[model samples]
Target: MTNTNNSLNSASSKASPKCWPILPAAGVGSRMQADRPKQYLPLHDQFLMDHTLRLMLSYPKFEQLVLVLSETDPYWPDSAFANDPRIIRAPGGSERCYSVLNGLRALEGMAAEDDWVAVHDVARPCLHHSDLDALFSAVENSAINNTGACGAILASPTRDTMKRGIKQPDGTITIDHTVERDQLWHALTPQVFRYAELKQALEFCLQNHLEVTDEASAMEQVNKQPLLVAGRSDNIKVTRPEDLALAELFLAQSLNQS
Candidate 1:
Protein backbone atom coordinates (compact mmCIF):
# COMPACT_ATOMS: atom_id res chain seq x y z
CA MET A 1 0.00 0.00 0.00
CA THR A 2 2.88 2.38 -0.63
CA ASN A 3 2.44 5.29 -3.00
CA THR A 4 4.36 5.18 -6.25
CA ASN A 5 2.52 7.63 -8.51
CA ASN A 6 5.23 10.26 -8.26
CA SER A 7 8.14 7.81 -8.39
CA LEU A 8 9.33 4.99 -10.62
CA ASN A 9 9.41 1.32 -9.60
CA SER A 10 12.51 0.40 -7.70
CA ALA A 11 14.65 -2.57 -8.71
CA SER A 12 15.05 -3.65 -5.10
CA SER A 13 12.02 -2.80 -2.98
CA LYS A 14 13.49 -4.45 0.11
CA ALA A 15 16.83 -2.68 -0.26
CA SER A 16 15.43 0.71 -1.28
CA PRO A 17 15.21 3.48 1.28
CA LYS A 18 12.09 3.62 3.41
CA CYS A 19 9.79 6.58 4.05
CA TRP A 20 10.64 9.37 6.51
CA PRO A 21 7.68 10.37 8.74
CA ILE A 22 8.22 13.87 10.06
CA LEU A 23 6.58 15.28 13.22
CA PRO A 24 5.41 18.76 12.48
CA ALA A 25 2.53 21.26 12.99
CA ALA A 26 2.46 20.58 16.77
CA GLY A 27 2.97 22.48 20.04
CA VAL A 28 2.20 26.04 21.09
CA GLY A 29 5.02 28.39 20.29
CA SER A 30 5.47 29.87 23.78
CA ARG A 31 8.74 31.48 22.77
CA MET A 32 7.67 32.78 19.35
CA GLN A 33 4.26 33.68 20.78
CA ALA A 34 3.07 34.04 17.24
CA ASP A 35 -0.49 34.45 16.04
CA ARG A 36 -0.59 30.70 15.40
CA PRO A 37 1.46 27.57 16.04
CA LYS A 38 4.95 28.16 14.70
CA GLN A 39 4.76 25.17 12.32
CA TYR A 40 1.83 26.74 10.45
CA LEU A 41 3.46 30.14 10.33
CA PRO A 42 4.37 31.34 6.84
CA LEU A 43 7.98 31.14 5.77
CA HIS A 44 8.09 33.08 2.52
CA ASP A 45 5.21 31.69 0.38
CA GLN A 46 5.29 28.24 2.06
CA PHE A 47 4.27 27.15 5.57
CA LEU A 48 6.93 26.01 8.01
CA MET A 49 5.78 22.41 7.59
CA ASP A 50 6.13 22.74 3.81
CA HIS A 51 9.87 23.28 3.97
CA THR A 52 10.50 20.04 5.85
CA LEU A 53 7.90 18.09 3.87
CA ARG A 54 9.19 19.35 0.54
CA LEU A 55 12.68 18.16 1.34
CA MET A 56 11.45 14.59 1.87
CA LEU A 57 8.88 14.71 -0.90
CA SER A 58 11.60 15.63 -3.35
CA TYR A 59 13.31 12.32 -2.76
CA PRO A 60 12.19 9.64 -5.22
CA LYS A 61 13.03 6.47 -3.30
CA PHE A 62 10.93 7.26 -0.25
CA GLU A 63 7.57 5.52 -0.17
CA GLN A 64 5.69 7.86 2.23
CA LEU A 65 5.93 10.84 4.57
CA VAL A 66 3.76 10.61 7.66
CA LEU A 67 3.07 13.95 9.32
CA VAL A 68 1.95 14.06 12.97
CA LEU A 69 0.00 16.97 14.35
CA SER A 70 -2.70 17.83 16.87
CA GLU A 71 -6.19 16.77 15.76
CA THR A 72 -7.49 20.05 17.14
CA ASP A 73 -5.03 22.08 15.08
CA PRO A 74 -6.95 24.67 13.09
CA TYR A 75 -4.62 25.02 10.12
CA TRP A 76 -3.73 22.58 7.29
CA PRO A 77 -6.28 20.34 5.60
CA ASP A 78 -5.97 16.75 4.37
CA SER A 79 -5.46 18.11 0.84
CA ALA A 80 -2.84 20.69 1.83
CA PHE A 81 0.12 18.47 1.06
CA ALA A 82 -1.45 17.00 -2.08
CA ASN A 83 1.65 17.15 -4.23
CA ASP A 84 3.11 14.27 -2.26
CA PRO A 85 0.83 11.27 -2.67
CA ARG A 86 2.52 9.38 0.15
CA ILE A 87 1.78 12.02 2.76
CA ILE A 88 -0.33 10.76 5.67
CA ARG A 89 -1.45 12.21 9.00
CA ALA A 90 -1.77 11.08 12.61
CA PRO A 91 -2.93 12.68 15.86
CA GLY A 92 -0.32 14.42 17.96
CA GLY A 93 0.25 13.94 21.70
CA SER A 94 0.86 16.22 24.69
CA GLU A 95 4.65 16.39 24.74
CA ARG A 96 7.06 16.05 21.80
CA CYS A 97 7.80 12.52 23.03
CA TYR A 98 4.08 11.80 23.08
CA SER A 99 3.60 13.24 19.59
CA VAL A 100 6.39 11.02 18.29
CA LEU A 101 4.97 8.03 20.17
CA ASN A 102 1.64 8.53 18.45
CA GLY A 103 3.41 8.78 15.13
CA LEU A 104 5.13 5.47 15.86
CA ARG A 105 1.76 3.92 16.74
CA ALA A 106 0.32 4.83 13.33
CA LEU A 107 2.89 2.51 11.76
CA GLU A 108 2.97 -0.13 14.48
CA GLY A 109 2.04 -3.62 13.21
CA MET A 110 1.76 -1.89 9.84
CA ALA A 111 5.17 -0.80 8.50
CA ALA A 112 8.21 -2.96 8.94
CA GLU A 113 9.00 -2.24 12.60
CA ASP A 114 12.70 -2.66 11.88
CA ASP A 115 12.67 -0.34 8.84
CA TRP A 116 13.97 3.20 8.97
CA VAL A 117 12.04 6.20 10.42
CA ALA A 118 13.31 9.75 10.45
CA VAL A 119 11.95 12.31 12.95
CA HIS A 120 12.59 15.97 12.38
CA ASP A 121 11.56 19.25 13.99
CA VAL A 122 9.24 21.45 11.95
CA ALA A 123 10.94 24.67 12.96
CA ARG A 124 14.29 23.45 11.62
CA PRO A 125 13.88 24.18 7.91
CA CYS A 126 17.48 24.58 6.87
CA LEU A 127 18.16 20.93 6.09
CA HIS A 128 19.49 20.84 2.55
CA HIS A 129 19.03 17.83 0.28
CA SER A 130 22.72 16.98 0.64
CA ASP A 131 22.31 16.47 4.38
CA LEU A 132 19.77 13.75 3.67
CA ASP A 133 22.28 12.01 1.39
CA ALA A 134 24.71 11.69 4.28
CA LEU A 135 21.99 10.40 6.58
CA PHE A 136 20.77 7.82 4.08
CA SER A 137 24.28 6.63 3.36
CA ALA A 138 24.93 6.08 7.05
CA VAL A 139 21.66 4.20 7.47
CA GLU A 140 22.31 1.94 4.48
CA ASN A 141 25.82 1.16 5.65
CA SER A 142 24.96 0.47 9.27
CA ALA A 143 21.65 -1.39 9.11
CA ILE A 144 22.31 -5.19 8.90
CA ASN A 145 19.35 -7.55 8.43
CA ASN A 146 17.11 -4.96 10.23
CA THR A 147 18.81 -5.39 13.60
CA GLY A 148 21.66 -2.87 13.17
CA ALA A 149 21.06 0.58 14.60
CA CYS A 150 21.21 3.21 11.84
CA GLY A 151 20.74 6.40 13.83
CA ALA A 152 22.30 9.48 12.23
CA ILE A 153 21.92 13.11 13.36
CA LEU A 154 23.50 16.36 12.23
CA ALA A 155 25.83 18.17 14.64
CA SER A 156 28.58 20.77 14.73
CA PRO A 157 31.62 21.27 16.91
CA THR A 158 31.44 24.12 19.43
CA ARG A 159 33.79 26.90 18.42
CA ASP A 160 33.18 29.32 21.25
CA THR A 161 34.31 28.67 24.81
CA MET A 162 31.37 27.70 27.05
CA LYS A 163 31.15 27.96 30.86
CA ARG A 164 28.56 27.02 33.46
CA GLY A 165 27.28 30.28 34.92
CA ILE A 166 25.62 29.97 38.34
CA LYS A 167 24.37 32.29 41.12
CA GLN A 168 26.53 31.96 44.25
CA PRO A 169 25.14 31.77 47.85
CA ASP A 170 25.05 35.57 48.09
CA GLY A 171 23.46 35.91 44.63
CA THR A 172 26.85 36.71 43.12
CA ILE A 173 27.48 35.63 39.55
CA THR A 174 30.09 32.89 39.03
CA ILE A 175 31.39 31.53 35.72
CA ASP A 176 32.89 28.06 35.90
CA HIS A 177 36.00 26.99 34.00
CA THR A 178 35.76 27.07 30.24
CA VAL A 179 34.31 23.92 28.77
CA GLU A 180 36.36 21.90 26.26
CA ARG A 181 35.10 22.86 22.80
CA ASP A 182 36.46 19.68 21.24
CA GLN A 183 34.54 17.51 23.66
CA LEU A 184 31.23 19.36 23.14
CA TRP A 185 29.20 19.08 19.96
CA HIS A 186 25.75 20.55 19.24
CA ALA A 187 23.17 18.01 17.98
CA LEU A 188 20.63 18.75 15.26
CA THR A 189 18.03 16.94 13.17
CA PRO A 190 16.53 15.19 11.22
CA GLN A 191 17.52 12.18 13.40
CA VAL A 192 17.12 8.90 11.48
CA PHE A 193 16.78 5.60 13.36
CA ARG A 194 15.79 1.99 12.80
CA TYR A 195 12.09 1.59 13.64
CA ALA A 196 12.41 -1.19 16.26
CA GLU A 197 15.39 0.44 18.01
CA LEU A 198 13.70 3.83 18.05
CA LYS A 199 10.57 2.33 19.58
CA GLN A 200 12.55 0.37 22.14
CA ALA A 201 14.59 3.43 23.11
CA LEU A 202 11.48 5.58 23.51
CA GLU A 203 9.60 2.89 25.45
CA PHE A 204 12.54 2.42 27.77
CA CYS A 205 12.52 6.14 28.53
CA LEU A 206 8.78 6.32 29.22
CA GLN A 207 8.70 3.05 31.17
CA ASN A 208 11.56 4.23 33.37
CA HIS A 209 9.92 7.69 33.74
CA LEU A 210 12.78 9.46 32.05
CA GLU A 211 12.23 12.98 30.72
CA VAL A 212 14.04 12.97 27.41
CA THR A 213 14.20 15.82 24.91
CA ASP A 214 15.52 14.32 21.63
CA GLU A 215 15.65 10.86 20.07
CA ALA A 216 19.37 10.69 20.87
CA SER A 217 18.59 10.96 24.58
CA ALA A 218 16.35 7.91 24.34
CA MET A 219 19.10 6.03 22.48
CA GLU A 220 21.57 6.98 25.23
CA GLN A 221 19.23 5.50 27.84
CA VAL A 222 19.67 2.18 26.03
CA ASN A 223 23.46 2.50 25.73
CA LYS A 224 23.22 3.14 21.98
CA GLN A 225 25.71 5.54 20.43
CA PRO A 226 24.01 7.47 17.65
CA LEU A 227 26.34 8.23 14.79
CA LEU A 228 26.59 12.02 14.54
CA VAL A 229 26.75 13.29 10.95
CA ALA A 230 28.15 16.79 10.70
CA GLY A 231 25.17 18.81 9.53
CA ARG A 232 25.15 22.33 8.20
CA SER A 233 25.60 24.87 10.97
CA ASP A 234 22.74 26.83 9.45
CA ASN A 235 20.36 24.06 10.46
CA ILE A 236 19.10 25.66 13.71
CA LYS A 237 15.78 25.55 15.54
CA VAL A 238 13.61 28.67 15.29
CA THR A 239 12.15 29.38 18.74
CA ARG A 240 12.22 33.17 19.27
CA PRO A 241 11.47 36.33 17.32
CA GLU A 242 15.11 36.99 16.37
CA ASP A 243 15.47 33.46 15.02
CA LEU A 244 12.94 34.18 12.28
CA ALA A 245 15.39 36.56 10.71
CA LEU A 246 18.09 33.90 10.94
CA ALA A 247 15.84 31.36 9.27
CA GLU A 248 15.19 33.76 6.44
CA LEU A 249 18.91 34.18 5.91
CA PHE A 250 19.45 30.43 5.78
CA LEU A 251 16.55 29.97 3.39
CA ALA A 252 17.97 32.65 1.16
CA GLN A 253 21.34 30.89 1.23
CA SER A 254 19.71 27.62 0.26
CA LEU A 255 17.93 29.32 -2.61
CA ASN A 256 21.15 30.92 -3.76
CA GLN A 257 22.90 27.57 -3.72
CA SER A 258 20.11 25.88 -5.59
Candidate 2:
Protein backbone atom coordinates (compact mmCIF):
# COMPACT_ATOMS: atom_id res chain seq x y z
CA MET A 1 0.00 0.00 0.00
CA THR A 2 1.17 3.50 -0.78
CA ASN A 3 1.88 5.91 2.09
CA THR A 4 0.50 8.87 0.16
CA ASN A 5 -2.70 10.40 1.50
CA ASN A 6 -5.45 11.58 -0.86
CA SER A 7 -7.43 14.68 -0.13
CA LEU A 8 -11.15 14.44 0.65
CA ASN A 9 -11.78 16.83 -2.24
CA SER A 10 -10.10 14.43 -4.64
CA ALA A 11 -12.00 11.38 -3.37
CA SER A 12 -15.43 13.09 -3.37
CA SER A 13 -16.21 12.06 -6.94
CA LYS A 14 -15.43 8.44 -6.14
CA ALA A 15 -17.51 8.42 -2.96
CA SER A 16 -20.66 6.32 -3.08
CA PRO A 17 -22.42 3.81 -0.83
CA LYS A 18 -19.16 2.68 0.70
CA CYS A 19 -17.80 2.27 4.22
CA TRP A 20 -16.06 5.18 5.94
CA PRO A 21 -13.95 4.94 9.10
CA ILE A 22 -14.52 7.35 12.01
CA LEU A 23 -11.64 7.34 14.50
CA PRO A 24 -12.16 8.94 17.94
CA ALA A 25 -8.85 9.91 19.59
CA ALA A 26 -9.88 12.52 22.10
CA GLY A 27 -9.55 10.63 25.34
CA VAL A 28 -6.93 11.44 28.00
CA GLY A 29 -5.71 8.00 28.96
CA SER A 30 -4.82 8.57 32.60
CA ARG A 31 -4.18 4.90 33.09
CA MET A 32 -1.34 5.03 30.62
CA GLN A 33 0.53 7.42 32.94
CA ALA A 34 2.04 9.07 29.91
CA ASP A 35 2.83 12.74 29.23
CA ARG A 36 0.62 12.75 26.15
CA PRO A 37 -2.46 10.93 24.98
CA LYS A 38 -1.86 7.24 24.40
CA GLN A 39 -2.62 7.60 20.72
CA TYR A 40 0.34 9.95 20.37
CA LEU A 41 2.72 7.65 22.20
CA PRO A 42 5.58 6.27 20.18
CA LEU A 43 5.44 2.67 19.01
CA HIS A 44 8.48 1.38 17.11
CA ASP A 45 9.62 4.82 15.88
CA GLN A 46 6.29 6.35 14.84
CA PHE A 47 3.31 7.61 16.79
CA LEU A 48 0.67 5.02 17.64
CA MET A 49 -1.91 6.95 15.64
CA ASP A 50 0.29 6.71 12.56
CA HIS A 51 0.20 2.92 12.73
CA THR A 52 -3.57 3.02 13.01
CA LEU A 53 -4.03 5.54 10.20
CA ARG A 54 -1.79 3.56 7.89
CA LEU A 55 -3.72 0.37 8.61
CA MET A 56 -7.07 1.97 7.79
CA LEU A 57 -5.68 3.74 4.74
CA SER A 58 -4.34 0.43 3.48
CA TYR A 59 -7.89 -0.80 3.14
CA PRO A 60 -9.40 0.10 -0.24
CA LYS A 61 -12.96 -0.28 1.02
CA PHE A 62 -13.10 2.98 2.95
CA GLU A 63 -13.76 6.11 0.92
CA GLN A 64 -12.21 8.46 3.48
CA LEU A 65 -11.21 8.59 7.12
CA VAL A 66 -12.80 10.94 9.67
CA LEU A 67 -10.52 11.65 12.64
CA VAL A 68 -11.97 13.34 15.72
CA LEU A 69 -9.46 14.98 18.02
CA SER A 70 -9.76 17.26 21.00
CA GLU A 71 -9.74 20.97 20.25
CA THR A 72 -6.83 21.45 22.65
CA ASP A 73 -4.84 18.47 21.44
CA PRO A 74 -1.19 19.47 20.97
CA TYR A 75 0.14 16.16 19.67
CA TRP A 76 -1.91 15.93 16.47
CA PRO A 77 0.04 18.66 14.67
CA ASP A 78 3.17 16.56 14.99
CA SER A 79 1.56 13.46 13.48
CA ALA A 80 2.97 12.17 10.19
CA PHE A 81 -0.48 12.41 8.61
CA ALA A 82 -1.19 15.81 10.10
CA ASN A 83 -1.20 17.23 6.58
CA ASP A 84 -2.75 14.21 4.89
CA PRO A 85 -5.73 15.32 2.83
CA ARG A 86 -7.49 11.98 2.87
CA ILE A 87 -8.09 12.52 6.58
CA ILE A 88 -10.74 15.08 7.46
CA ARG A 89 -10.66 16.47 10.99
CA ALA A 90 -13.72 16.87 13.22
CA PRO A 91 -13.84 18.69 16.52
CA GLY A 92 -13.94 16.22 19.39
CA GLY A 93 -16.80 16.28 21.90
CA SER A 94 -16.82 15.83 25.67
CA GLU A 95 -17.80 12.22 25.37
CA ARG A 96 -17.09 9.37 22.96
CA CYS A 97 -20.64 9.26 21.60
CA TYR A 98 -20.62 12.98 21.02
CA SER A 99 -17.29 12.76 19.21
CA VAL A 100 -18.67 10.02 16.97
CA LEU A 101 -21.76 12.15 16.31
CA ASN A 102 -19.55 15.08 15.33
CA GLY A 103 -17.71 12.86 12.88
CA LEU A 104 -20.99 11.73 11.31
CA ARG A 105 -22.11 15.33 11.00
CA ALA A 106 -18.83 16.21 9.28
CA LEU A 107 -19.78 13.78 6.52
CA GLU A 108 -23.21 15.35 6.12
CA GLY A 109 -23.15 15.94 2.37
CA MET A 110 -20.41 13.47 1.55
CA ALA A 111 -21.93 10.24 2.87
CA ALA A 112 -25.43 8.98 2.10
CA GLU A 113 -27.71 7.91 4.93
CA ASP A 114 -27.67 4.31 3.78
CA ASP A 115 -23.89 4.15 3.53
CA TRP A 116 -21.88 2.14 6.07
CA VAL A 117 -19.73 3.86 8.72
CA ALA A 118 -17.17 1.93 10.72
CA VAL A 119 -16.33 3.56 14.07
CA HIS A 120 -12.93 2.40 15.26
CA ASP A 121 -10.87 3.19 18.36
CA VAL A 122 -7.63 5.08 17.65
CA ALA A 123 -5.80 3.10 20.34
CA ARG A 124 -6.49 -0.17 18.56
CA PRO A 125 -3.44 -0.30 16.26
CA CYS A 126 -3.38 -4.04 15.62
CA LEU A 127 -6.67 -4.56 13.77
CA HIS A 128 -6.02 -7.33 11.31
CA HIS A 129 -7.16 -7.13 7.70
CA SER A 130 -8.87 -10.52 7.86
CA ASP A 131 -11.00 -9.32 10.76
CA LEU A 132 -11.95 -6.24 8.80
CA ASP A 133 -12.97 -8.45 5.89
CA ALA A 134 -15.16 -10.54 8.18
CA LEU A 135 -16.90 -7.43 9.52
CA PHE A 136 -17.56 -6.10 6.02
CA SER A 137 -18.93 -9.41 4.81
CA ALA A 138 -21.19 -9.75 7.84
CA VAL A 139 -22.54 -6.23 7.54
CA GLU A 140 -23.14 -6.45 3.78
CA ASN A 141 -24.94 -9.80 3.90
CA SER A 142 -27.12 -8.85 6.85
CA ALA A 143 -27.80 -5.22 6.00
CA ILE A 144 -28.64 -5.80 2.32
CA ASN A 145 -31.04 -8.70 2.96
CA ASN A 146 -32.72 -7.06 5.98
CA THR A 147 -32.35 -10.41 7.71
CA GLY A 148 -30.50 -8.71 10.55
CA ALA A 149 -29.99 -5.20 11.87
CA CYS A 150 -27.73 -3.03 9.76
CA GLY A 151 -25.37 -2.45 12.73
CA ALA A 152 -22.73 -4.98 13.70
CA ILE A 153 -19.66 -5.06 16.00
CA LEU A 154 -16.46 -7.08 16.08
CA ALA A 155 -16.39 -9.00 19.40
CA SER A 156 -14.82 -11.98 21.12
CA PRO A 157 -16.59 -14.42 23.40
CA THR A 158 -15.50 -14.39 27.05
CA ARG A 159 -13.01 -17.14 27.78
CA ASP A 160 -12.63 -16.93 31.55
CA THR A 161 -15.14 -17.34 34.37
CA MET A 162 -16.91 -14.10 35.17
CA LYS A 163 -17.84 -12.60 38.52
CA ARG A 164 -19.72 -9.71 40.11
CA GLY A 165 -17.90 -7.87 42.87
CA ILE A 166 -19.06 -5.67 45.74
CA LYS A 167 -16.80 -3.07 47.27
CA GLN A 168 -17.21 -2.88 51.03
CA PRO A 169 -17.00 0.38 52.95
CA ASP A 170 -13.72 -0.80 54.47
CA GLY A 171 -12.20 -0.88 50.95
CA THR A 172 -12.36 -4.65 50.81
CA ILE A 173 -13.98 -6.31 47.86
CA THR A 174 -16.32 -9.29 47.99
CA ILE A 175 -17.80 -11.39 45.25
CA ASP A 176 -21.52 -10.85 44.96
CA HIS A 177 -21.94 -13.97 42.93
CA THR A 178 -20.47 -16.09 40.16
CA VAL A 179 -22.00 -15.08 36.88
CA GLU A 180 -22.67 -17.36 33.95
CA ARG A 181 -20.39 -16.62 31.02
CA ASP A 182 -22.38 -18.31 28.28
CA GLN A 183 -23.69 -16.08 25.53
CA LEU A 184 -21.42 -13.31 26.80
CA TRP A 185 -19.01 -11.56 24.44
CA HIS A 186 -16.39 -8.85 24.86
CA ALA A 187 -17.27 -6.05 22.43
CA LEU A 188 -14.47 -4.74 20.22
CA THR A 189 -14.16 -1.79 17.91
CA PRO A 190 -14.68 -0.96 14.20
CA GLN A 191 -18.40 -1.32 14.90
CA VAL A 192 -20.22 -0.96 11.57
CA PHE A 193 -23.61 0.71 11.19
CA ARG A 194 -25.83 2.45 8.65
CA TYR A 195 -25.10 6.16 8.65
CA ALA A 196 -28.64 7.29 9.49
CA GLU A 197 -29.41 4.45 11.87
CA LEU A 198 -26.35 5.09 14.04
CA LYS A 199 -26.89 8.83 14.08
CA GLN A 200 -30.51 8.42 15.20
CA ALA A 201 -29.63 5.83 17.82
CA LEU A 202 -27.06 8.11 19.44
CA GLU A 203 -29.49 11.02 19.41
CA PHE A 204 -32.11 8.84 21.07
CA CYS A 205 -29.69 7.87 23.83
CA LEU A 206 -28.75 11.49 24.48
CA GLN A 207 -32.42 12.46 24.70
CA ASN A 208 -33.14 9.67 27.18
CA HIS A 209 -29.98 10.34 29.30
CA LEU A 210 -29.01 6.70 28.84
CA GLU A 211 -25.43 5.49 29.20
CA VAL A 212 -23.90 4.45 25.90
CA THR A 213 -20.73 2.50 26.60
CA ASP A 214 -20.40 1.51 22.97
CA GLU A 215 -22.12 1.91 19.60
CA ALA A 216 -24.02 -1.34 20.06
CA SER A 217 -25.64 -0.07 23.27
CA ALA A 218 -26.93 3.04 21.50
CA MET A 219 -28.57 0.86 18.80
CA GLU A 220 -29.98 -1.42 21.50
CA GLN A 221 -31.96 1.47 23.02
CA VAL A 222 -33.77 1.70 19.69
CA ASN A 223 -34.50 -2.06 19.83
CA LYS A 224 -31.91 -2.81 17.18
CA GLN A 225 -29.95 -6.03 17.71
CA PRO A 226 -26.56 -5.70 16.06
CA LEU A 227 -24.80 -8.83 14.91
CA LEU A 228 -21.47 -9.83 16.51
CA VAL A 229 -18.67 -10.83 14.15
CA ALA A 230 -15.97 -12.79 15.99
CA GLY A 231 -12.55 -11.22 15.64
CA ARG A 232 -8.98 -12.06 16.73
CA SER A 233 -8.33 -11.71 20.44
CA ASP A 234 -5.10 -9.85 19.71
CA ASN A 235 -7.09 -6.86 18.47
CA ILE A 236 -6.40 -5.20 21.82
CA LYS A 237 -7.02 -1.59 22.82
CA VAL A 238 -3.87 0.02 24.27
CA THR A 239 -5.09 1.36 27.61
CA ARG A 240 -2.32 0.68 30.12
CA PRO A 241 1.43 0.99 29.64
CA GLU A 242 1.90 -2.77 29.32
CA ASP A 243 -0.53 -3.05 26.40
CA LEU A 244 1.81 -1.06 24.14
CA ALA A 245 4.39 -3.81 24.13
CA LEU A 246 1.75 -6.42 23.38
CA ALA A 247 0.43 -4.33 20.50
CA GLU A 248 3.95 -4.09 19.05
CA LEU A 249 4.27 -7.87 19.21
CA PHE A 250 0.94 -8.35 17.47
CA LEU A 251 1.85 -5.86 14.76
CA ALA A 252 5.15 -7.64 14.20
CA GLN A 253 3.39 -10.99 13.87
CA SER A 254 0.96 -9.51 11.37
CA LEU A 255 3.83 -8.13 9.32
CA ASN A 256 5.57 -11.52 9.20
CA GLN A 257 2.34 -13.15 8.07
CA SER A 258 1.83 -10.59 5.34
- Candidate 1 lDDT over 1-258, as tens digits, reads 355632445645665546556665568888898998877777877787778777777776466877887888777763357445677777888888878877887787667765778888878878777887888777777774454554877778788888888889999989967777775889888888878888888888999999789888888888888888888888888889888778888898888978
Model 2 regions more than 4 Å off: 1-16
Full-model lDDT for every candidate = 0.77, 0.91
Q: Using alpha carbons, what is the TM-score of model 2? A: 0.92
TM-score of each: 0.86, 0.92
Backbone clash count, each prediction separately = 0, 1
Give the candidate number with the greatest TM-score: 2
RMSD of each: 5.2, 6.4
Point out where model 1 deviates above 4 Å. 1-13, 82-84, 144-150, 168-173
Positional deviation of 91 in candidate 2, in angstroms?
A: 0.6
Candidate 1 achieves a global lDDT of 0.77
